[model samples]
Target: MYVAVKGGEQAIARSLELLAEARRGDVAVPALELAQIREQLRLGVARVMQEGSLYDEELAALAIRQAAGDMLEAIFLLRAYRTTLPRFGYSQPLDTTAMRVRRRVSGTFKDIPGGQVLGPTYDYTQRLLDFDARQPAQVACADAPLPANMPRVLDLLDAEALIEPIEPGNDPEPIDLTREPLTFPADRAARLQNLARGDEGFLLGMAYSTQRGYAESHPFAGEIRMGEVDVWVCPEELGFAIEIGSITLTECQMINQFQGGNGVPPQFTRGYGLAMGEGERKAMAMALVDRALRCDELAESNDAPAQNQEFVLSHSDSVEASGFVQHLKLPHYVDFQAELSLLRTLAARHHEDTDDTPLCKHGGARP
Candidate 1:
């Protein structure tokens, strides 16, 4: 349906030139280095990597710069670049229990095993901006190094047999969503994969809706940990796992009250979310929505929009949504002309029919 126009090739080229010039802005200003964006605007870089489904910080920074700091566009750029990459062996499942804890907190408990280690966060800071550029302040050092592996707060509840147990090893192998087209009645693994790369803003809104009585899962932020976790890969030839590298991650575990159904006893349920880099908000939002989507599996009411898997998964990709909505700006000349011709024909037919009829004083056409 999209026929290429013969003309305007030169104009498009000129427009692209203008776009490039505009992206550079004033030449007087120094160009932004990829390293600066990757380090200084780390959160933005993390969001790009998370949504783009790519973990290369340098590339993410480049995409961000190329997109002129447009987060969604940056995500799209990174994702587009990712499609051309060659497939390598998949990494082993991350072990969060062994994370080099930088930040760990829990709303369910005040004093968790590794008392709250509040890392660099904007939570307690004043919103006021300082006009003067200030030097970095010195950070106080901890008396003792943190334990190699901190015990998960959820484990305490698990010990009491209060929360549902997620036993490992029995679940089927998860499919690569990138290579496979998503189908209806998707399993939890697929759903989680979709959500992990979903637009953060969309997920946040859906999660907020759940709290506003839409799905009404009595959710508590059981634990949110941000740190670096080692990535391992096992090659077919080697038959042994090797540490490829480590990547920063944020993991959120949400506890929700569940009056068990489907022939199960009442027990607390859990919703999990994980993201690349320090993406606490994204992780938390994902967790809430994840729980809401589990309504069918948990035998709860699936009346809310958040519980609609089709709607959520379909609309979650910012790149796809942006393309579909923005494509209206494209040349629909043929389609528009057809519609206009049809309308004109209908109007002419009505006018011709009216010309042979007599109009009464009340403006009604007389037979």
Candidate 2:
């Protein structure tokens, strides 16, 4: 049996009107331009693209504007738009090692090939409010031209047989998570893909948990690189791969100590993360969660929340989480009425049964 609620249309219309008014409050102030958001709030755009699994900056910016500055809503809009596009072809696996080195840093090495090129970072910026009406723009020029190519820090450790080796040729064909439903015991590629789009705050908290003795992890930022990487696609007619422009990316390689088990010698283990645009925090947090999720493969204890893939991946999406949590505000009168009726029936039955019974010493009624 179903009974539809009434008067929701007027409420929804009024709510939408209120939202529009709120979104463009006070016509005196200039409306936010899409280009402004694209240029100034690039990090926010990058986050939307990464989570939405779409790389179009312009569309992301538009989505951001339409979402009224709500990042999660922007991500949802982008993701919904992504579903309408037809699949052309899958791009080749990106080679982050060949990134046109920009901001490269390593915590384990004091001096590496790139010499800790902190190209653009807020590490040294003082958290102070600016009082000046007009702020001066920074003028930066590279000092002692950076090396065109820098060796990955983990590769250096691999050369000396200090870290567990990743056989380049033996990787399994990655499952297309976008097409297939994600299941338990996911492969490394699937896990990486899932984490790549996982909610930033959620993954950040999970990563922080690992650092706080949740998973017994002692991880180091072996390398955190931000640069441009070329995208390639192979066409059936061409029989060869062609470059499809390049996009900026941030890659994080976390190195964690691993005690040998499962017939493998003790060595440093690796966790990889790659994100669209300059998303170092996302990359780093993904790396940490990646390492934590590999507890079983690395022969470590799986007693932490990060290690639970079902729990982590299920709640990782902003769109799904927001829908579920926000849906609580919707009308539930019918369901509530059903529960109320059941409670009344139970009370009546209980009263009938106890009507002829005497009061117990401990209480007024029993059963």
Q: TM-score of each candidate? A: 0.92, 0.92
Best by TM-score: 1
lDDT of 2 by residue, 1-367 (tens): 2222346666788999999899898999999988889988899999999999999999999999888989999999999999999998999888888899889999999988768888877777786766762576677777677777788888889899999888876888888777898998888889999989989999999999999988968999999999989999999999999998999999999999988877898899987888999899999999999988888877678889988888888888878899899999987889999999999999889978878666788977666
Writing each residue's lDDT as its tens digit, candidate 1 over 1-367 gives: 1234434776798899998999999999999999999998999999999999999999999999999999999999999999999998799889999999989999999988979888889899787896553766566887788778899999999999999997886889999999999998989999999999999999999999999999959899999999999999999999999998999999999999999777777889999999999899999999999999999888788999999999999999999999899999988988999999999999889989878666889999875
Give Cα-based local distance difference scores for all models: 0.93, 0.89
Model 1: lDDT to the true structure:
0.93
Itemize residue pairs with steric clashes in candidate 2: none
